[model samples]
Target: MAHEVPGTELNINTTSNDQSAEVGNAGGVASAGTVQAPVGTASVSRKRQGSPLEAENPWVIDIIREATSKQIHEELKASFLRGEPDMSAATVFFAEVNQKIQKANDEHGAERDRGTIPGDAYEKLYADFKTALEKAKLERNEEAALYVVQETHSKFAKFNQEHHLPEEWNINPDAFKHDSMPEVAPKPEPQDNDSLFSGSLPDYTGSETDIPDNVSTLEELEREARYNQSLSAGEVLYWWKRGVGTQTFVQYGQGSSKTYRIRAGSYEVYDPESVPRILSSGALSGDPSSVSCQGKQKLQYRNEKGRIEEAWAYTRDQVRGIVGVGWKVDDDDEEGIEPLDLLVPEPYATYPHTRILVLWVDGAVTLEDRAFIRRITKGSYLNVARIIYHKALRQEIRYRKAERLPYEHLLDRMPTRAKEKQDIELGDEEYEQDGEELNSVEEVQPEYRGSVQASTIRSASTRPPSNHGRSRTSEVRFVEPALEPRRPTSERGTARPSPNRVPHKSVDIEDPRDAKIRWLEEQLEMSLNRNHQSSYDSSSRWRRYNRYDGRQSEVSEYTPEPRRRRRAVHRERVWDNWTGSWVTARRVY
Candidate 1:
């Protein structure tokens, strides 16, 4: 027997013993089906001569097939003649389908537990099984019809043999039915459960008149774009295409939801970071004006003239004025674009005295404007532009209000020195030696502002005496000294008056020990006064009582001179010849 070509009416025949073969043509139909007896199980050669695609294929599998009408008729006739077939002889098509589905499901479950499947292949496999099961039923029923026809024929053949019935009786099984009997139509087999993915095709029906194309006349595209060009700012426009998800986004509360038609396969994809809530024009796709960015975003657009036009920042509710009160993100916009939470402009104290400068600025106050400031600072042209644009805005916003240093720019401009105490009373000679006193007021020098210093300029007369004051101390200052001509070193030696010696010639000189005692006394007096002030200022009584101060209070402007204590103890010295000690020379109270 020869094997037949699967779909076409072509047959190839060859005997295992006979190498040569004859090509038979029964109306160009293959003779394989008519050949009887196996030709020793000869293998069919799949070699094709012409096409590369067909040449290498070793197996040909047919996906879908149905019984032809003639085949169906023959099957019915055969089934009638055979009548009821032995249940064992009737073949069960796809008998292992359920087991295969269960096994696949078990494997799929295990894979799901192991997390190896890319998608839910189990569902697809199950669906496929259901589909295969239905196809198998069709094949089985078509094959079973032959047996039904065999049974019918046998029933009529018995009558033909017994009573010489006519041929019409075989063809028409219900020919002898009573007049009152109801004629019945074959019960229809259930069609395979409509495929799980039986979705209607997307309707892309529209006419050129619907959206009279723009640039139907323009030769090339240009940047001259307007916001309200396509659909008016608030108008609704629906759209769809193959790859891109269906329809322009719509805020459902608006009438656009009901007004527009929804075609099949519409979807919105969401992604954070990369995807903004309302994408501005020229962001991810198309021209800026093609889609409204929810109208809440502040976008810079160009008019027909090409000048950049800015829209003031808008509130979400305010955006409703453009897209209608229903202005909101799509239901699928969860991942797409989130709502905005503008950062409050809080000046971070990154720079020294930044808060003070910000306070000095008329209105600048928050960290919120940092991004805006940075953007402005990033000039399209040059870094110098960053300085100008942002600097101008900063000045407008009063970001850095540090005025021209408030004084002259000095050489060492960055130093910040502590303020020196003022108002100490000083005698004239000391002043004359240190530097010349200003005879009149002087203007602040530019160099002073630059760096030299901010010297405390309090008036001497206005300074108050300290609590321990013996003679009032002179107030100290750090002002720039007036320029004076320097004396020659040769002359400086003789011309420079010695601080301790008198200007005139003198023979007697003060003992060095006496100078030390004088200095020690001054230090002791200052220390005593400091202790007294501290004891008074301290809140703890124990600290005050423990001060151990034994000195006189100075006549300060704040306090009158205290009365001197009685001389209860006097210093007396007696020479101890054996110990060699002088008691009178000791420091005594």
Candidate 2:
């Protein structure tokens, strides 16, 4: 048992009578009859080094106990070999062993009672260990702890190896095992941001977030730098400079209908474990037409079988960098990934998660674009309008306290109370069936209602006689009135052409000879009438008629006789035949 010094609770366990004798000589303990030592005076006042008092420091006892046990284990073996007579050694060994066993018991007891190690006791143990190592003049406490740590590690390793573990353990399994493991391919690593902003680009790794560092195309870099000045945090913008555009990611599916806030850093993309950084400055307008990177030019190293292995540590930006000179003028054109386009950057070599925020200004601030702007900015219409004004008008937009702008006022701006329309959610099955019913009702409304109205009107106009006693004939006569006949041309007093009368000779003359003879007689009569008319003078009522005779006229047969007599009677006179007058003619006799 450890001897308690006067006015002290120090447990100094000594083996054999010699050690106890030495301790008693150095510091005497008060006997039962002796004047009781002052309880807290000397012991508390005493300057203790190496081991402090029990209450002030219980750890001393604990360390002593453990050291005692180790000593005992060693002594037991030594004593067995020596075969006794060395009482001092035996006593010292047992004393140390007993102290260590008590300490172990105390520890187990504490755990049983409290369900965990006491905070104070742990502090004591750690302190004692620290003191022991210091006293021993060890180079480092870690060197001592390594023994326990290595033993524990070996035990676990042996167990795992015996049980046939799949592979070696690692804090970063992918970083170590990716290249060697043929079964699982490594995902493309994110490139350094520095490389992407620059114009030197490498291959793309099929990830939108794999934009490079400073290496961007001259055009892309310039465009992005300009756009960068105009963005807000969490505002999703297409970073086309690095070939990471809104259209590039759109193929996966319909993106957030509202603009989703962009997470900062390339690692955040497709890496859920990556802690995304939010852009505090809210860079709004840094959209580039295309991208480039330095991931292609950078190199890195890894530890192999006691040697460093040289390999590429690509960043998201570098992995996406491709060999292209110009921007993709067409927004919809998305190129496929190629091997020659792979890039690796330096900074991404060791950092865990490095991501960049991409804010997309899809269209100029329009009403439709405002919806997405609202989601991304987490702002209201008025707020977005203010942003637009700052961007477009280059001046701060202000509003009256009680008034609103046209666009702002027209938004879904009704008061909460006014917007209390009932909205009940229905299952898909119910919704589809209800929609069908509604469509059917709409389809039948016009056709059936018009037909029904027409039928009702007809029934009202031609109602079946209420009094069935009415005669059917009277009903029919009243319903059907008499009609008037239409007048013919003769009855209307209009003149009609008279029928031609045919002579007996000309009538029904089908033969050509008969028709000709009848036609000549008619012409002869017409000519005779015309000659008689021409001979009459307007002053006289009498007209000279041509007297028809059976014989031919002599004057007609000898026409030369009349001509000779006429020439003798009026040799110098010329007849005006056209006007039927006489006139003198130039004599050419």
Candidate 3:
């Protein structure tokens, strides 16, 4: 008799014929229905067992199907009278199911290697498995969900080992586990907005006796005491007035000894006891009008005509409509052969409010100007005074150089007035010519104006002037020997020639302008050579597009061809295998 296993297909044979019955008789337990097998002697022949996952067990199949549907129940019946399924049985069933899924993934990988599956097939499979795992989680089948997560992670690991994929492609089992757990809403935190202070408050029993008599209440007395204690050493009081924020003169030391000016709104730290008498007399005032103006007094200085003149000095603030104070050439004073064109004229009706006096004498600022400025500003505005003095000095120096004054040689390297004016006029002409070309070109294509202007300016700056059929004298002005400054004594020695200094010229022999023009021509020739070489190289590179049959071709003007007619033709060419020749069988239009 053979009895089948309850949950599996395997059968157990209890019928004994020879060896198993003799062994059962020796053991004193011989029975017709039940017989023990002898040691080392097999009674029933069973098939070789492989992995449990490879077996076609009925209970495994039923549990896997139930897990897939997420409808697992305790009283569910399995095939072949299998015992009631529990969590252990479900775990085993899911394990086998996971093995099957892995085997299917291996098949998919093989198909991918063979190029029979789509590139995203693995992705689709992963998404479907994830969906099933989520459904199991929602149905409260934790065992199936856990197995799904395990299989997904294992597949990810295999993919990483084989394909060397990025870490982002791997599945995070912890994330899914966290997602399956129940989520509790966060608790609200308590807020306290009633109190302004953080710790405990101090006790006040109204028994304090150290309060000042001037303060009426204890709070006011405490405030006064705190204010007094906050003052730094050497400071009796800090004073600041509201709304009167302009700069004002303040006297702080003993009468007429030390005094200074400070802005009104800013704080002033001083000892009031030191100047109590002055404070009592109310000498301090923030009014701008109260300050004395030293500019009202008239000062005397020698004029350019060797005569003393009286002029009133003024501070910078007193002047209105005055652009600046500097030496300027007089347009009317041109009677003398070497007329004193430079002068510091008196303030006229056009600028009547102007009062700052700028006096020039012997190609420099007069001593009277410095003395007057020092008297007006005392020592506070010396920097401003220095700046004004330098402005006047620079103007005078520039005027002298322009006029070719006798003392021009004493100055350092300076460009001649004619050379500077020529350079300026040339630059202006080049800029205007470039601008005209730029405007004309921009009329045709406005988008490329910026680039064209940049290239044009760069070329104009480096291009040498064309002198074809043009007189050199017209382009280069000749400066007379009388106008040239005398050479200094220091340059007469055997000293090395300076790179910046122009060569010394003989007084009666050669003209200096000839040498200058020759040097300029040499420089221009060198630049022209460089420009020609570069242009030749660039033209050679561009000539590649203008070649025809390996030979250079001239570019011609573009002309449109005249339109004539339109024609349509159809022809059939067939190969004659018998004659081995192509024949036109038919022609149609």
How well does candidate 1 match the true structure in TM-score terms?
Answer: 0.15
- Model 2, span 158-265: residue lDDT tens: 532332211121012222122212232356999866764575755667678666674567878665754653332122223322334221111110111111222223
Error of 1 at 440 (Å): 52
lDDT of 3 at 276: 21
The full ranking of all candidates by lDDT, starting with the best, is: 3, 2, 1
**98 in model 1: Cα distance from truth in Å?**
32
Residue 308 Cα positional deviation in candidate 3, in Å, after optimal superposition: 22
Task: Return the TM-score for each candidate structure.
Answer: 0.15, 0.16, 0.16
Q: Evaluate residue 267 in candidate 2 and report its C-alpha lDDT on the 0 to 100 scale.
A: 18
Whole-model alpha-carbon lDDT for candidate 3: 0.36
**Per-model lDDT:** 0.30, 0.30, 0.36
* Model 3 agreement with the true structure over 18-121: per-residue lDDT tens digits: 22221222343234322222232243222112323223222222223223332222222231013112324434443444454344334333221221112343
